[model samples]
Target: MAVKKPTLFAAPLANNGSKWSIGTETNVMKGLSQFHDPLINWSVESYSIDSLGESIALVVRNPSEDMAVTPRVDIYLVSADNSVKPKLLTGSFNAISDSPVFIKDGKKSVAREWDCSPESIVWSANGQTIFAVATDQGNNIIFAINATTGNCTRMTDAGSAMGLGTLGENQLLFQYTEQNKCVDIHILDIETKEMRRLTDVNSDKLRNVYIGQAEYFWFKGALGDQVHGWIIKPLQFNTEKKYPLALVVHGGPQASIQNIFTSTMWNSNIFANTGFVTVQINFHGSTGYGKNFTDSIKHQWGRYPYEDLMIELDHVLDNCSYVDKARMGWSRWVRVTAALVCHAGIFSTPGAWYGTNELWLPEHDFGGTPYDPKARSNHEEFNPERFANEFATPTLFIHGGSDYRVGVEQSLAPFTLLRRKNIPTKFVYFPDEDHHISSDVDQIKWLTEVLLWISEHTNTTLPYNLNQ
Candidate 1:
């Protein structure tokens, strides 16, 4: 098997009627001959053999680092007997990345990343169709690929559909979630293209809760590309009245704030319920857009994403009459504090010094290590400390002492700077917690502190009594 890159080969399939056996070194066994194009630089992600062992189904991917080149993922079919070369069975599309769908208090939400690698692939009993679950737009939906024609059909609509399993020949069992709904077991009939719910366990608990309505919109962002975002209106919303804006910027930089439900601390509904119009932007570096858009943030993180957020924020303020631009406030992850400082003079983690346990992340984003002369300029250009002189917005610093990924000192530095400058700022420290506030008590305190800080800055009264 003469191939440039390391190749993965499946065990020899049982010979049904062909002369080829386990030891045969035929076209199928020869790595380059399988694709008949050695320069393709493809690797198999997953494979399945038919019951008869005559055909093998494979999921192949070609990844590249160049931002101009889009990554390719496709399904291929090849004969086990070495009788034919590999044939493409589907168009280019990401299978699924390590994107996680969170389930909390019966509600579900998704956190998407730039990597769109598939989770699992399975062939139908008859070997006529293949089923795959992938992240599309903001939802993880199911796709059915035709075995022979390379045609693809979407099986599920609206929400994060996952945990795919073969129930029978033409039926599939899976889990489903939505923006206002929780996780539920579902059954899908592939032959008839019909779906039915198997469980509604969270309906009773969520029946009386007031959940805000989410509206999605797109606008021209940096590079003239369309950027996606969401606006969640307060419950019992009045169009005639102006409301404060709670703009939430997601972490990952590579991750996206999806359209699914979340009942936990980071839920968008929390802001809406507090009489604020909540907004979220899936900026340039967010996942599910495509490889090029995701990689576009490399070496230009602070420039493009910040431009997208400000541009989209302007778009919202211009179009949404109900939003109060004067009372606008935002919260974001610790790593991307440059945006916060640049936009509002508000800053978060990693003050004057940048230190993180994840070396690969910084190296990959900045194009090289901090010590590398060619990449040092990129780091200094985006660091939040460079803009410290302009810091004026009343800021709140929160950190967990056990957070090794981004040490607590990152938050302390900025807090100290603001105090020395006599800026209105507060620090909330959790000595026992880690990167995330996991305990129920800490969760409540975290939310309270955040809401209180935002309410104070925006000069808005809390919908619920904080003293209670």
Candidate 2:
């Protein structure tokens, strides 16, 4: 079968004088023009022409090729004069050349994922170098390419570039994050590639409150590969006193939790401010590290990654003596497949609150990939229904009725099973919401219920707002 694809083509400009055409003429065009070879498997994402208009740069994504969850993005360079064919830029991989320049700020303050994209190719004043944003080791940074020598030099590393623009002859203006701080303006010298901060937007306001301190933790996984995670110490934490621990599991099973200011259904800062030590583990399948790490959990959903999380938990508990082992609680965004598996194994844990349960419905959880009988059987093995009789830990299941991604029925099934088996379970479904409860009213109610459930089960109470 011939695969149809969108191909880029260019045409020459033509001018007609007043005497050249006296009547209206309609010409029939039938033939097609092709720029690159038809055998290429990639599609153009975005394109830009250099300042001199000598070469054109194409941000292309290889649909046939993928790394972990997303496709492999590369830049293809072609001559605007049609002198040279399109060639993939050397040393480019896992890049988001077509990503939009958005300010990744939180509601309360600016965010840390301050990434910026220059107009594909921002030719230097001398037109000798091209500056752009590229992803490196999960973080996006500014990069400069020597157009003539083909040498690539990194420009900025303080934080991801949120916005980019040329300043003067040798300086570039951009908004970026610094360390664990919020977004701010900075100047980058093109010649020296040195960056200097120009603004501190929220420093004074943030100084009044205690912000959670995040520290990176690394340990060897089951396969001897290094695993990474972060432990956020509660505000005004004291090393002498034991603190309650809350473990957060991210969804997508394939997605990752990077070192950015993130505030979603599972907010680390909220947990920290509420007097609980928080931990986020990027298991074997999380993105950003590399293709190998993301693909490690392909078919082994609840196996390897679960072990990694357990190992990570053990390491944190052993290293952080201030974490009260008896007061540990579990929480996660959306589907809680990994948490469900581990929660079943850990009977001594106080309680677990999973925002969504995707275990019973494997088709929805795995994006309808259970075609063969064996695959369906494997799904049954990971199904929480199998252990309904043995489920003892009190678990709360909250879901959105309109969540078509992972239907509310997924949670309903397990919730029913647990209740029938007298496993102490609660189900809170929101009919007006979708995969996520967006409205502030629903969000407050959801968080309040979650905190109340945890407190009631763990013998610890959070400062709940009665007005909410």
**Best lDDT among the predictions, by candidate number:** 1
Write out the backbone clash pairs for model 2.
114-160, 115-161, 115-162, 116-161
**lDDT (Cα, 0-100) at 67 in candidate 2:** 34
| Residue pairs whose backbone atoms clash in candidate 1 | 96-117
| Candidate 2 Cα outliers beyond 4 Å, as residue runs | 1-138, 143-159, 164-169, 178-180, 191-193, 332-368, 463-468
Supply candidate 1's per-residue lDDT for 148: 60
* Cα lDDT tens digits for candidate 1, 1-468: 546754445456456686656654444434334344555455656666656666666655544422123334566667776577766655444332222211112222122332443455566776666677777677787778765665677887767777887898889999887766778899999978798999999888988777876788999999999998888898679999998888888777688876677667878888888988889888998887888888999988788998988887789889999988778876542221211211112232223124555555666777776677897887777887777787666778788877755667667777788899998878888889887778889889988888888888788888779868
The C-alpha local distance difference test score for the whole of candidate 1 amounts to: 0.70
Lowest summed lDDT window (length 10), candidate 1: 336-345
> Each candidate's lDDT (Cα)?
0.70, 0.60
Clash numbers, per candidate? 1, 4
